[model samples]
Target: MARAATATATATASCAPRLLRAALLLLLLVAATRRAAGAPVVSELRCQCLQTVQGIHQKNIQSVKVTPAGSHCAQTEVIATLKNGQKACLNPAAPMVKKMIDRMLNKGSTN
Candidate 1:
């Protein structure tokens, strides 16, 4: 009976470390998963715009966002937010968008 008790204790002692290590690994994975879930989502991996418009009236535009060419996109993108809350992708090569970009640049430089 004494030998059996000692052998049982020995087995439990060896198993305790492995069980603790597994518990720690599980906790780390859960924490990592929660952090990844909390992180901001990137809606699209590629460019946001696929089609482009020729022009838009300055009065109709409430805001403009310009994205430069990079790994995600090959060409410059110009997006205009209209007063009605609609977003339109403008052609970067379009005269109106180019002028708008120039105006925005000049305005920024003066500030």
Candidate 2:
């Protein structure tokens, strides 16, 4: 009985480090997943716009591209391409764009 108790204690001692290591590894994986989930994937916005004249004629504007130009600590540059292929920049540095990106990024976190 004494021998069995000693063997059991030694076995548990050996398992303790392994258990601790496993827990640490699991914690690291969870941290990594959380970080990855928070990271944003770059994307381009594509859409069409229409204008009506005389309440009858319809014009189709094809493929407006919205691209990210740069990212600062608090803001980013979003370039908006017009239907005529002209490009304009919408800066997150702007109050409206900043709020929009903030809301978008926040909404992203919930998913």
Candidate 3:
């Protein structure tokens, strides 16, 4: 009976570390999932890409690029890189942005 008790205690002691490791792994996964789920949401405000081209532009946007939102925003986003290396986000489906995307697509197709 005493030998059986000692064996059971040792088995439980060995299992405790594995159980703790599993619990820690589960917590890390949950944290990572929560962080991924908290990704930036798409804004409702309509972006005017043309405005960046006209008038006294403060942004000085050098280039505009399309970025597809995967599991986050659902909609596509346009990122405008400024001359000073700053970036601004815009709506991809906006008038000027759409024109840019279409132009790029057409250019790629012809190549």
Candidate 4:
């Protein structure tokens, strides 16, 4: 009985290292696959503004959100929500939009 118990313990001990090695190998393969094939392969879509208007009246604009260029987009985006519950993309380079942004920025700074 003692010999049988000893044999079982030995078997379990030997299998433990094999099981642990297999698990470690699987983890390494999964990590390597993710590193090699995951990030760039998936399409990272950015830059929401496909088209932008040159101007919109200041009073008609309910809110404006300005997003600066970053990893998501190369150009600055100005999105305005109109009082009529419609959203419009404004061209950041446009003279009228630039003036409106400047005024809003100045007003914000003063407050």
Candidate 5:
């Protein structure tokens, strides 16, 4: 009977660590999901100039405009005005321009 008790205790102790690890992993997953859901939606735009430069090997874009649209997590409109007099409005934030705009807007709020 003592031997059986010792075996049971050992098994219980081993199970405790596994349970704790599982709980920690579950908490981490929940936190990550919440963070991702709370993140802002960024939008992107592409114009004639962007298309033209994309074909070139080493072309630099001149001007890009990123504007925030809507109050909620909905789609945002971005306007890209290139140096070549081409304009384009796109929904879904452009990665580079969206980062820049978000940073600028966030900074403006702190002041």
Candidate 6:
């Protein structure tokens, strides 16, 4: 009876480390996959925002013009005329920027 009890205790103690390691490995794998899956979406959004800003700068824009809704953009886009009188497109997803755009639209409509 004493030997059986000792063997059972030994087995449980040895199994604990293996169980802990397996659980740790499972958690790491899940975290890695989640990060990998979501990374592209985050990067793409940043890329699109930067690209839109770059395009606007390249055109040497003057004042920004906002449309309540746009045919080409996801939400609203800002149109600006350059010193050379060329039009440029700007993204309006940022909070502060969107507010400014709303003000611009409202002010324009009033006049």
Global lDDT of each candidate: 0.93, 0.54, 0.69, 0.92, 0.57, 0.65
Candidate 6 lDDT score at position 91: 56
User: Candidate 4's residue-wise lDDT over 59-104, tens digit each?
Assistant: 8999999989888899999999999999999999999998889999
Best by TM-score, which number?
Answer: 1
Clashes of 1: 0
Provide the lowest-lDDT 10-residue window in model 5: 49-58
Clashing pairs in 4: none
lDDT of 6 by residue, 62-82 (tens): 677665543333555566678
Candidate 5 positional error at 12, Å? 0.7
Name the better of 4 and 5 by lDDT.
4
Query: How many clashes in each candidate?
Result: 0, 0, 0, 0, 7, 0
| Per-residue lDDT of model 1, residues 30-75, tens digit only | 9999988887565555898899999988999999999898877998
Stretches > 4 Å off in candidate 2: 39-111
Candidate 3 lDDT by residue in tens digits, 1-111: 999999999999999999999999999999999979986566533433332332214347687777565654455667778798877766555576677678779999999
TM-score of each: 0.66, 0.36, 0.42, 0.59, 0.36, 0.41
Q: How accurate is candidate 3 locally (lDDT)?
A: 0.69
Q: Between 4 and 5, whose TM-score is larger?
A: 4
What candidate 6 gets wrong by more than 4 Å, as runs, is: 43-73, 77-111
Poorest stretch of ten by lDDT in candidate 6: 41-50
Cα displacement (angstroms), candidate 1, residue 24, comes to 10
Q: Per-candidate RMSD vs. true structure?
A: 5.5, 14.2, 8.1, 6.0, 14.7, 12.6
Candidate 5, position 79, lDDT: 54
